[model samples]
Target chain A: MWYIAAMALSIGFGLSLAALAGAFGQSRAVSSALEGMARQPEAAGQIQTAMIIGLAFIESLVIYVLVIAFLLNGKIPAVDTIAAVMEKAH
Target chain B: MSLELPGWLAVAEEVFIGYFGPSYHESEAVFHAALVIPLLLLFVFLSTRRLEKIPTGLQNFAELLVELLSKFCTSLIGPHGLAFLPLIGALFLYIFTMNMFGLIPGFKSPTSNVNVTCSLALVTFVATHYYGFRYQGMGYLKHFAGEPLWLAPLMFPIHIVGELARPLSLTLRLYGNIMGEDTAIAVFIGMGIGAGYLPFQFPMMALAVFTSFVQAMIFALLSSIYISGATTVHEHHAAHGEEHGHGAHGAAQAPAHA
Candidate 1:
């Protein structure tokens, strides 16, 4: 029971933390890229490409966490199953 | 939360099972991917049937796509990058089509499946190293060895890990994003069914279109970057600092931006 609860909690907390960090990172990257484009509109294309690449790289990290959450989610048994196992153990 | 949209291919599978027994099972993703390939080939065949100096209709669309991809390849990978247009352009079209396929009723996005994305990433991984060796020969291994000769032992392992991580990251990134998007759309669709058949997922479908394009573009862009990084010689790497700078910036900016 405790194990299942912990696993569920970790998945939630892990995803939320990753989302928070990813959002911050993406915002910073877009802001800087926008500023650069504003300074040199002619170079906006180059800056935009760089920005998207940077965003993808950052986004991949969050995706890594999501994958881990998925793996952990799979490991979790149903609450009813756990309760039944506990009853049997008793 | 485990609700999933039923794909048309599932019905086909059922018919096959009824006719051929249980031995004829096939995944919907595989069916969708197979369906997409022939459709893509048919499009290419139709578009190229009659080449015209003054393009129109399908020919114009095909030419525009090729031209945009050509420019993107050249801009990112220099003149030599044109050699990779076939691979990059094919990836963009295939991935974009697969991503958007989920928006159609009774169809699923093949890209939402990790196995499909993993295979695509493997192609990029193999192509990257193949071009690396083709361009640099045995000297390509020197890249794993850092600037200081003493650092070779440490740097070699780090480089190997980084190289391996590239495909893994690519696989997970594409798989997770598409899977999440599809699942969201499915959940919304489920809600719509409960709400007297309101199209609750219409807005999500619009967002999916944007994300599908972005994801496809990113996949193509990163594959080109990886290939270019592997193929360019050290001399060109230093000389074209501005062009190479994007690769370095992409790596360095990750943590700082985060």
Candidate 2:
């Protein structure tokens, strides 16, 4: 029980760090895009599109970490069903 | 913390029968590593066999490849980077080949494995600090200690944790992407065959190819960026000196502000 709680807390902490990093990354990317647009006004459309795509890629890493955290926390329904059955039999 | 699931959800299955050491595991990443080792070795042997002042055919192509890689590294690490060209080139080629291996039949991409991705990330982690130390000597250790005595408490943990996170994030990102794509393709293939929907494989195949290439590019680009960051010294004062000119006023005032 304590072990599981600790594991969950760590996962939650890791996820928050990832989220914070991602937020910082996205803001920096947007600011860079805005700066580029200011430098070359005509290329704003292209710059914005590229920035959005890049932001998606960067954010996807955080999403991947979140999925892993969920997986690690043993939250999958199929696996939980099997484990429940095994525990009942035991 | 391990899941035991049945049918296609079970990630491992024998892909092929072989007369060699063991039965070739279909989804096992070690099989991919075994294939990559020899392919990379052969490439290295052939490319390094002969020296040519004026090159032609395969040698010309190989030299051109090295030249381009050299230019990329040099631009990232400055002119002195040519010394590390062989290491970076091998890393890029090995990673690129390992990544492309997923497109081959009956072979999983070794890089698609978290263990393999972590190994690669660890290599990069070591290489970054190794080069940093090589260039800057023992003072490279000071990077962790913070610039001044006052901020060490705050900066120390942040710097250390951030450094540790690099490999974890790098490995997890690459592994998650490649493995997820591989799983999706497998699921698609299984479902398509079951439903007699063969056309579904085409789009999945196209997606797999695109994902493999993009993952390889991202891995290489991130590794290069990390190497550049680790090696290049941040010259905050130099920039200030340039702005205010290199006279006595600039140098004395900057120290006063500090």
Candidate 3:
């Protein structure tokens, strides 16, 4: 039971942190890009394209955490396995 | 309470297994990868036959997609980017198709499998280097060397690691997105059965399709950006000439327009 809880917590905390960082990074990137475009409307096309690519790179870092979680997720104790262990304990 | 389930739901688990190997992981993603080819062939044949001066059917749709894809590539990579239309277009269409396929009740997206995504990423990796070497010849290796000569040792490994991370990032991005979408949809449907209530599927499927497009666009766009980076010198020179022309026009028009 302790093992399962730890596993769940790590995955939850891991992704939450990742998403937090990613969201902040993306908003900053877009905000900066918007500021640039607002100052130079002629450069809006270039800024928009660069913004999309920058946002993807930022998002991918978060996805990397999810990938690690996915690999670890398989190792989590299944409910059936835990139930069987409880029955054996009783 | 017993409920009726769609016949297709029953067959959803079935997929044609690939004969390529022992079917490592015994997963059917391999078969789906193989299946994309014949599907494309059939689609192309059906859509392109009997071209008319004015297309009225699938041909029109096909032409429109081609135009849109080429325009997208040109915008990102510039004029010379048209030369990369075939590679960019195929990657976009294939990734998009594989992604959307998962939304079908009985179909699985091959991209949900890491192996399939790795193969896709490998192509991008190889192309990035191949064009880099082709464009810059021996100078391509210079990119690996850090800006200052003394930093070569530190920068070389860093560059190599960063380069290697590109494919891993591409693979993980698509695989995780599609796999997560597939899992969410499956789990929701399974819940409907378990809770004895109709699954709240409409929103899930809609989100799946939407994310599928987003993922595909990201993959294709990144691939083009990598290719453009690989051939930077050529594009840089070309853009220089175009910029001069544009500058002259802007100067000439600023007074008249303003």
Candidate 4:
């Protein structure tokens, strides 16, 4: 029964945690890069390139979490069994 | 807004049995591979054939593509990057073509599969480490083990995890994005998820095409970045002062940039 709840919780929380973190990191990165570009427009090209590479790296972390979520789903207990057990408890 | 998704895509593709390594199953990915490889080869052949002094048609388009790719790859990797043109160029074209094919009505994109993406990531993984060892020799292990021998126990695992993460990330990103796009399209066409209009699906399809291009560019760009990171040596760069040609020198010159 707990396994059933754990499956959904992990899938949801795992991905959301990743997504939330990634979004924050990306926002910070883009804002900082933008500020640097604004300060010195001449170096904008370098800033942009580095920003892109850094962004990809940050996104990879979220992607890893996504894969983990999928793996977690693979071990989820049979839904009907869980439903039956839960209903009997109720 | 009724969207029609073909039935075959719902299941695996064809499979043939028992040759050398288990029953060879030709899934949608392998089927796409069968189609894409020959198509890619034909494209290369046609674009590159004929030694005309004045380029026209396919020759012109091919040259422009080569130039653009070379510029991008070299800017990322420096002088020795020219040697990588074949690998990087082929990767870009193959990925780009497969992605474009995905945009077509009835075609399966090879990159939509994790297996296909993993294979490509494996190639990049091999190339990165091979070049690292070749360029840095015994010292390449220093990269994996990190600095300070005492930290070996800690850093080694960290580096190992980091290295392994790279290919896994590449595999997942490509597979997830493309596959997600495919699924979204299918969902949209079948029931019109949000907009609930047939014409709304067109915009989604357009978005898929745009995403295909962006993902292809990101894949190529990230591969280049990884290769450059693997190949760069602080000692060699400082000693030789062989700055990358074109516009990258500006980045190298700016000490405070990064």
After aligning candidate 1 to the native by TM-score, how far in Å is the CA of B27 from where it should be?
Answer: 2.1
Among residues 3 or more apart in sequence or in different chains, the pairs in candidate 2 whose N, CA or C atoms overlap within 3 Å are: none
For A1-90, candidate 1 gives per-residue lDDT tens digits of 677888899999999999999999999999999999999998787778788888998998998888788788778887788889989999
Better of 1 and 2 by lDDT: 1
In model 3, the runs with Cα more than 4 Å from the true position are A34-42, B1-25, B234-258
Q: TM-score of chain A, model 3?
A: 0.89
TM-score of chain A of each: 0.89, 0.73, 0.89, 0.81
RMSD of each: 4.0, 8.4, 7.2, 5.9
Q: Which of the predicted structures, 3 or 4, would earn the higher TM-score when compared with the native?
A: 3
- Docking quality class, candidate 1: acceptable
lDDT of 3 by residue, B61-167 (tens): 99999999998877766566788899999999999998988777666788888899999999999998998899789877766774465888997887788789889
Predicted candidate 1 versus true structure: per-residue lDDT over B78-162, tens digit per residue: 6687899999999999999999999999888999888999999999999999998999898788777755558889978888888
Which candidate number would show the highest lDDT if scored against the true structure? 1
Candidate with best TM-score: 1
In candidate 3, position B225 carries an lDDT of: 74
| DockQ of candidate 2 relative to the true structure | 0.16
Query: What TM-score fits each model?
Result: 0.88, 0.68, 0.82, 0.77
- Number of backbone collisions per candidate: 0, 0, 0, 1
Q: For all candidates, state DockQ relative to the true structure.
A: 0.45, 0.16, 0.39, 0.30
Q: What is candidate 4's lDDT per residue for B1-258, written digit by digit as tens?
A: 112244344432323224334433336577776688898788779988895889999989888999998887777777777888888888888887777676677677778778899999999999988988888788777666544568889978877887788788888888777776776677766665555555456787889888887778778877776777677665754356554321123223322312
